[model samples]
Target: MAPVSAPDAALRFVHPDLDRGPEAGLVVAGDGRLALATGMLAIRQSILMLLSTTPGERVRRPDYGCDLHRLVFAPNDETTHGLAMHYVEQAVATWEPRVQVIHIDAHRDPHAEHVMQTELHYRVRRTGIEDSASFGFDLSGGGG
Candidate 1:
């Protein structure tokens, strides 16, 4: 039998959903399914970071609560998007005054989740806040 030719290095791994590997430098359009999962993960991480920074005195407030800030991954679908937006708007109106919001992600999410967060903190200034402020220690690769 002839020796087997090695599979194309680039095509060796195929995503079950994608028949062709993405072309070089081409970006995949964001998928609603992936966005929903990623957004949830990012929101969860943000909340955890917020809680970790809370001073011991502030943890017991009865009025304070956390919820998934709802959002629609589909922009043109009004019935669904409107419902999602309405839910988030109501939650924001109810919760903004009681709790602080945090965003933790490598790349900013531009969907409904991030939009609500942006509006929530629009007035707050991040002037002196370093990227490492929330992380407790600066991991910037620079000498002292």
Candidate 2:
């Protein structure tokens, strides 16, 4: 008799993957509300770091770039996104008119989108001011 395969045996799944070139233009909606997919925590961190700058501090980059900006976490959980937005809003408030948010992720972060929108709305309402700016939020991924 042949041996039976384990019910939960680990298997490697592979497909004929195609090598796509580099990405093109990337844009981040300044409306404020944003939500990322799962497996994108690193990207969220990077955005926070970028927005949060002290009086004088040098920006440093690690050897390899980090990739984490998804929003497929546990059901109805927005902790990470909330923290990120809080930091972003604080930075924006401190550096208003000179802060440009750039979000690079592998998917459209719904949490991030929503957060950004909410912050921007609040800022507009409180300050009664507006300005045009350029930001980047690169989303790259293969829809499963």
Candidate 3:
């Protein structure tokens, strides 16, 4: 079944702190109330958090996280590269609904032993602004 499209609405920057995530925005007011992050700030944090999480690490939500951590020990090859790409896409799609991923590239560093780097390109949902982030997973360790 096809999903219904949401009506076109202006992007509203004001919101409660709960939707923004665990950490407060880098900007602050003298009153000390955490200001909600907007534009690139919010998108960057969401991407980082989604990619850093492991599937089983979250309480109650066993399936909540990118599969990058699972590929830490997997043999690095064409198959592994594809799996890493899939993990990034799935995690980003599931966790951060505010942005749509445009491109994802994952490859192993030849000189750096046991390292896989993922480059992500995405656009914000409402604003249509594009940005990129690079993440590295140390295969020597168990996490990304």
Candidate 4:
């Protein structure tokens, strides 16, 4: 009998619940087939979608997203970044029950006058694995 490789061994022990199934919604694949995000990728994409959506944008779910858009025209300062961080933290915690937020950091982009960078650090609640996501909030009339 052939021995199992290390990678295969690791796959054998993957917790089933860590990747239960595809998340909500569907996307068109490269070949036009419907696809869905799964596991951590799904979580990350959901985070981005939640951040991009503004409060009251969704007709049925009025409170589905972060309030990042409200600061689009605000001054690019610590206060703005602070509010952004707060909004992100609140949204992820409230909407995404799969992960526990570790930290949220926001700051003005050093080279871009109208862009602020926000990074979210979180640990998957079920797996305890940590990951981070970064987003550029574009101001100056450009969408985030």
Judging by TM-score against the true structure, name the best candidate. 4
The alpha-carbon root-mean-square deviation between model 1 and the true structure, to one decimal in Å, is: 19.6
Better of 1 and 4 by TM-score: 4
Q: Give the TM-score of candidate 3.
A: 0.70
Order the numbered candidates by lDDT, best leading: 4, 3, 2, 1
How far off is model 3, as Cα RMSD? 8.3
lDDT of 2 by residue, 34-80 (tens): 32221122222233333433333554533122122342232223554
Decide which is better by lDDT, 1 or 2. Answer: 2
Angstrom error at residue 126, model 2: 12
User: At residue 5, what lDDT does model 3 achieve?
Assistant: 36
Which candidate has the top score in lDDT?
Answer: 4
Residue 19 alpha-carbon offset, candidate 3, angstroms? 22
Give candidate 2's TM-score: 0.26
Model 3 C-alpha lDDT versus the unseen true structure: 0.72
lDDT of 4 by residue, 1-144 (tens): 365443222211112212234543444567675544466766676777778888899899999999988888888899999999999999998988888999999998998899988899999888899998887887665663
Better of 1 and 3 by TM-score: 3
Positional deviation of residue 82's Cα in model 4 after best superposition, in angstroms = 0.6
Off by over 4 Å in 4: 1-27
Score candidate 2 by lDDT: 0.32
Candidate 1 shows a clash count of: 0
